[model samples]
Target: MTNPFTRRPGGTPGAHLPLALCAAAMAVLALAAATGLAVDGRTVLGEPVWLKPFKFALSFALYAGTLSWMIGQARRWRRTLWWLGTVAAAGFVLPEISAITFQAGRGVRSHFNFETGLDSTVFAVMGGAAYLGWLMTFAMGVFLLSQKRTLERPMAWAVPLGIAVSLAGMSVGYLMTAPTPEQAQALDAGLKLATIGAHSVGAPDAGAGMPLTGWKTGAGDLRVGHFVGLHALQALPLVAVGLRLLARRVTVLRDLTVRTALVVVVAIGYGGLTWLLVWQAQRSQPLTSPDATTLTAAATLLGAVALAAAGVLLAASRRVPARTPVAATR
Candidate 1:
């Protein structure tokens, strides 16, 4: 299908250039990162230097694309709204990716790096950009909430709720900025500190981590939660879209309220899972090896979702009437 977001004001392709351009730029960065990884054997924090850039570029590409498509669906003040969003992407968002890529080229950690003046400056820029970008996204979410929508029940909730969830996910990064025990001890001693914070909590930053992603193998890695939370931007809305597609084959999905209920259940479950990941990370537990407690929590969460889904389906079967025509749901 022709994506509406890729088009300009009158159904041509252009106007959302800031977001589209960011997506394109990220793709280029991904290519460059791939090349760098292949040619340069240098590793930072025990991982390939360009690896961070490669992961970040691909993620941002999807992030930007999703936001672009979402804002493109606006009916009221579309041009102005998208223009404002585009500007936000250009001004605040672009700097973030740029800083990461720049630090990658320098062969140093981009995050929590305050060792030197230049690294501190770059990290400061990234922090500032994060704040501004989040503020802009919140503003966009509010504006989206105010506008009337033509989407189905699931999608209608998905777009704005996805933004809300993404905001929470973005906020999760702040936890990584806090001082660890060692850093706190150094600060208490009034000694100069090179790095104030880190991604790994119980373990050191450059310790043994999972392949490719570099998530800490058996320690509290904040990145896991941050990654999971941030991607909900794509996950939640895409769930709604996937359900809509499934409706063609399953008659139970034809009821508007049923679909809405399912969306709510999934959203709640997704949010729960995000929190679970953060909780697990904070406890210094490796994601690959969740213990009994973590396993129980996860099982409980899954059970709740199943119960809720069964309730929705059962209620729909009794209340919505069997084989309700698809048109009636709308």
Candidate 2:
């Protein structure tokens, strides 16, 4: 029996090395954060400029590490997948992180900055890299789905679900890039400014936030959904693993039907939450400030999810075989 985490002999090195290197970079950034290195400007959240690099470094580490683990499980197209994943990291992730870090070091905004030729170029490059990364993720999801039988049942389902949800979540950022009415008016008023691409809605990016996350407390922030959706890759698979362990302990619930139903339920719930966050952000409502509309929408989502879960469980129960009761020895 082989441990999934350990690299097999003669296996092609995938994103593991790049992920490790990124981890090292994250360590350096963490040190910088701790040392309070001289960062020229604060983020829109008024946090130390080092915070951006520190956060991105951690995110990249998780992204690379999770993908590397999944790629290692690939029984077919191992080398090709490795190459593709590496290209994604090198061509997309690395460039984006580097550009952000570079801008942070210079005490300037990396995103939505069309003020100068250089800033516009960097922003364009980052945007291109982001699109490429999303495409690569889509490809990875397709490959995982094609090889579903080779993976653990929970993981097999999780891979595609996670990627799909993450992409959906990421799409919300596009709305933020559109020029607000005020921004358009400003542009028409002889201002050289092109558009504001920041994440906050109905308010400026600079404001009171929730500690390190920097999510706006006063207004809607699309990054909440974006962050939650991106992490589904990790969160879903982890929940699947836990469910598998629980199934082992509970004999009556050991059927694959039950386990699969649980996974489906969790995925649906997770997706609903992602949508709720995005919807809330669009309405310019803070996470903490839920009004009547929010409550009604939330209730509807929960009711729908509950109905779906019941249907799945009932359908599964009918298909699954009844367990034989064992007679106790006298």
Candidate 3:
């Protein structure tokens, strides 16, 4: 079967440019990874530079790939693709643009000690990156829902509405805490210690002990947000499939009931997984602990169960009752 996203109109693919850019960006990322690994020592490489930029580049490439594939489908899909492209650009630009403000104060200072000012420039850049990331999800949700073949109005709104609520809640919390200089310093110390213990915080190390660097230094609740946020990729898509199944039977009470139950099960499973992540972060235990190990195993099991149940429900919904052929009245 033809890939739904990649179908295009005439000769010479419309996405050629974007696809080429994606390939180039991926190549750059590969080079950066090799270079990062090949260098012997920290100082010998001068500054560990290419990796961060490469991440941004790869993000663009992924977005571009999505756009290239989607834009050629139909007018509606094309519109959706345009929005997605805008979203992708914003995701890449926001952090870089925000970094300018951050860099102005520190002038390329990437180190963090307790003495480092509370307004660490990288925070601004990262915050921008994160906010943009969420917005990208919102746009994606809209596009997914806009699928004329299978889109329920309520489900379509969920992505944007959920994001708005999450961001609002987070913003309210930020406003509530106007940390003192001393408090900020303490927070910095805690973060630094966690980073030191973890050895590597970010910039994907396949061998790195910690799978999640986002929760390394954060409190439980904060860590939960980051962890769940990370898994949105899986949770959202599963939920979407479930919703599509659920919406089909909305008019029929019996089938609707099954769908509703399926949706609830899916939501609860995803929510539980999210909560566990937060709890783990709050606990701040190393990944090697028996308890942590058990919890991870349990979470994986739950995810598998949820996915399996969803698939079963979707299949069952598609099965219509056998129809007898009508007698020839003529």
Give the per-residue lDDT digits (tens) of candidate 1, residues 152-192. Answer: 66887877777887888888889999889999999999998
What TM-score does prediction 3 earn? Answer: 0.49
Winner on TM-score (2 vs 3): 2
Per-residue CA lDDT of candidate 3, range 1-330, in tens? 332243345522255244445546555654664465356233211333333343444444444454443344233555455556555555644454345323332434222212344545454455566556556646654664455343333233333333333333233223212343444576677643211111112221223232223222222223334434444433443565565554444432134334434544555455555445444433544334326565776668697767866675676557633331221111
Largest lDDT belongs to which candidate? 1
Arrange candidates, best TM-score first. Answer: 1, 2, 3
Q: Which sequence of candidate numbers ranks them by lDDT, best first?
A: 1, 2, 3
Score every model by TM-score: 0.93, 0.86, 0.49
By summed lDDT, the worst window of 10 consecutive residues in model 2 runs over 321-330
**Minimal lDDT window, size 10, model 3:** 194-203
Over 4 Å off, model 2: 1-16, 37-45, 188-190, 310-330
What pairs collide in candidate 3?
224-278
Error of 3 at 206 (Å): 18
* Candidate 2 TM-score over all chains jointly: 0.86
What residue pairs are clashing in model 1? 8-12
